[model samples]
Target: MPAQTGLRPLNMKHGWPALALLPLAALSSIFNWNPAIILVLNITSIIFLSQAITASSVELAAHLGELQGALLSATLGNTVELTAGIVALVHGQIPFAQSVMVGSILSDILLVFGCCLVTASYNKDVLGFNNALAKTLSSLMMITAVTMLLPTALYASFPIAEINKKVLLFSRGTSLVLLLLYGGYLYFYLGTHNYLFISDNAETDSDEDDEPSSPLANRAKLALSVTRLIAAVVATIFCTEIVIENTSDMADTLGVTEVFIAIFFLPIASNSTEGVHVIAASRTGDTDSAIRVIIDSLLQIGLFVIPFLVVIGWCVAEPMTLFFDSFQTVAMFLAILVVNHLLRDGQYAYIHGAMLLALYCSLVVVMYAR
Candidate 1:
């Protein structure tokens, strides 16, 4: 005989612990406010993040499903950092953001990867170097690193104390050209046979993550999906600005540079969701999800963050090129290159993970030294 507790599905499913976490994270955000709004936002963010993970896990039930959950986590976590950046920008705390961006970038490349490697070591083989793919990703990361030099170059080469029309034009032109070229390369590369060489995964492993149902293309109306995606992005930027503005005010009291604030705190803030998801993924042994979260953050940093900051820098009269001088850039470059090599073999072994974790640890030390 079965002992049945008559409870509603929602009530039973919406366990008290998960619900409790949201308020806790939101309240955490308030601690950062005058009376502290960080507490509220942090707690809400935590809550929302948990819901997102719950939703994603239910919707996407394979190992691959974990990817969406992890990405959701990263996105939420990064919001904190973004909030800080927006605050600094509005309040004219440029240096603080500079610091935060550096830290955030470093954290994405090293910390996430290291964590992934360490946990992955328990189950799979460490990845072997895929030189061709590694070199390609390394090249892009390097280019991005060099693009960071644009602001410095503009300052050093053109000699502008403030943002002149000509400088702005030049910068915008450079951004457009680089963006298009890189985009085209991505399209071609991903579409081409070269992708096969770059991406080496065991067929059996991939099957383990395959969806039971057909993909959502037919059921999920394309127009609606596009609109939802756009709305999500717009909303992210809006909320991010609010959070950034508040964080900047506190930075002065904390006595940290915007650069440091941007790098360390901003990431911790924005990546709130991702960090939690990573832990969740680790507990569940969802390696693919772990990998997806890492890649998603990198892409966001490389794609979204770079361009957004460039535009924001223009708005704020600061050089977007400040990213280059930070050792964080070098650290980012190293992580991507190393990862490409490691992932190329597709084995996903512990030693490879160890190597990655080791390098990440080393970079943290180097970042401290620099």
Candidate 2:
């Protein structure tokens, strides 16, 4: 939809290949029925999502005023679950899908943002973070991330299992508490006038909104855009279904962790468009816009993913709970802590991204190791 004709060089390379492979993957998903085939389809989605991030990299070069539009496209693109969640709710699937939405939010904040921060860090120095504002918003996100635990905490009157009542309570309680601690460090480091969290430098020689791949010639061309938008939305939806359907079956057949599937694979697939966004943002050096996309991704996960999943689980609620799990909860805490300390100067770089990536990588490694 967004101009596939006069395409740019496609600097964000991972996704183009993935996108190209999709037709075959989709076909395999339908006919093969083999879990491995499904897993391949799911993984291809991840590659495409990674490409979305790369594709959006160019938007960062736009003028300050145009930044808002860039944010809209990138953030909205990263937030398919939010759209899907709304669609599902309207269609009356709200019981279990709701929790998946929560999980999505959690995954975005911890996993996506974490990866962004880490990758940005490795790429270059973060300019600096907004000390006071970032801390406040981080706190808000942290609260929302952990609030689902009310059920587990209040209902656990007796000590249970290897984890126990006290352990579980501490696990949840301390997770939130660490955010405060992390925030405190960030405040002192940035607010106390001792340190700056991000790099002051941004990418240079970048024209902010100069869409490398132009699809418009004048206002008269606007009419053509509508058809493209619809097609894009429809394509995304069909692709998403293929992604989830195959991934779900694969998880069942392979006995891999469900959270692992959702956290690592689902977002990658759903956010395939992000690969396009990231490269554009990175090329333009508009870290702010890129970060905003990251934020939108997190919000969509929260507002869209958890809600939709909650509805599905609600429809079949006797066996399992579709709410937040321990691994995800811990990951959220760790993410908040990292970003709370990292975003003070309102700039980003290689180190910040690296740190965030490290956290997520550790989580994934451990999950696979188990």
Best model per lDDT = 1
Each prediction's whole-model lDDT (CA):
0.49, 0.48
Name model 1 segments beyond 4 Å from true.
1-100, 122-127, 153-170, 193-242, 252-258, 272-296, 312-370
lDDT of 1 by residue, 108-184 (tens): 55676667666656665444334454455445555665665555556566545554554557655666666565455
Per-residue lDDT over 1-370 for candidate 2, one digit per residue giving the tens place of the 0 to 100 score: 1111112325544344555666776777668668776677645654554444334433321222233433344344544465444444444443323434544554555555655554444545435545554664565455545654544554465445533444434444444454355345334433563322222323222333234544455333334333333444455556555655455467777777554665556555555455344445545454444554555455334433343344443454421232345555566656665665565445666665656657667877876665
Q: lDDT value for candidate 2?
A: 0.48
Superposition error at 366 for model 2 (Å): 3.2
Cα-lDDT of candidate 1? 0.49
